[model samples]
Target: MPRRSGGLRSGTHYKLRIKSRDKGAHNIAKQLQDFKKEDIVMIRTIANCHSGMPNSRFLGKQGKIVGKKGRCYAVSVLDGSKAKIVVAHPVHLQKLGGLAVQISKTNEGVV
Candidate 1:
């Protein structure tokens, strides 16, 4: 017998399931969203969309838009003390307007 290896989507059953009411075609508007650098965005997995989805660990985390890679945006998120860049599609991200946005605005001149 061999030990099983876990893959990216192996344990993401609950983290990536779509709701009953929202299980149809994906919204085009979401796919067309644009994020400028410093904008804060929340990572939300849309189970139906796997093309440009980020890792499951990044789900529910907020990150700042650093740049764009191909059709996805590079989001800078702090995992513990280290910062990691997560490239994700716009459909899996929801723009947030709150203290996170203010923090990014204030730190604009620091870096």
Candidate 2:
């Protein structure tokens, strides 16, 4: 058997750090943000909240909101030519343009 090595977030020490002043301060509004279907959203990781985070490589990638999964949202993004859905918490999603988008129906699920 092969020995286990690095974990999924092994090299993301800097990518997941919160500012000193913002440490331990939870943004209640963001944590309870509401995202509508077809809206555009950006994936930004919140170090304080470790739940439902997408892959680090997907950080800063923008995608369309497909649906909701529990308290998280389903975001559809393009990985090369293939489309991928990344499920993340609302705190990690920043709505783009602060407006709802009108698009076709999408598969109702999150990663």
Best by lDDT: 1
lDDT of 2 by residue, 1-111 (tens): 997678988888999888888788788999989988878888999888888988888898878888999998999987765689999999899987733333322432321
List where candidate 2 sits over 4 angstroms from the true fold. 1-4, 98-111
Q: What C-alpha lDDT, on a 0 to 100 scale, does residue 106 get in candidate 2?
A: 44
Among these predictions, the greatest TM-score belongs to 1
Cα error, candidate 1, residue 80 (Å):
1.2
lDDT agreement of model 1 with the native: 0.87
Instruction: List per-prediction Cα lDDT, in the order shown.
Output: 0.87, 0.81
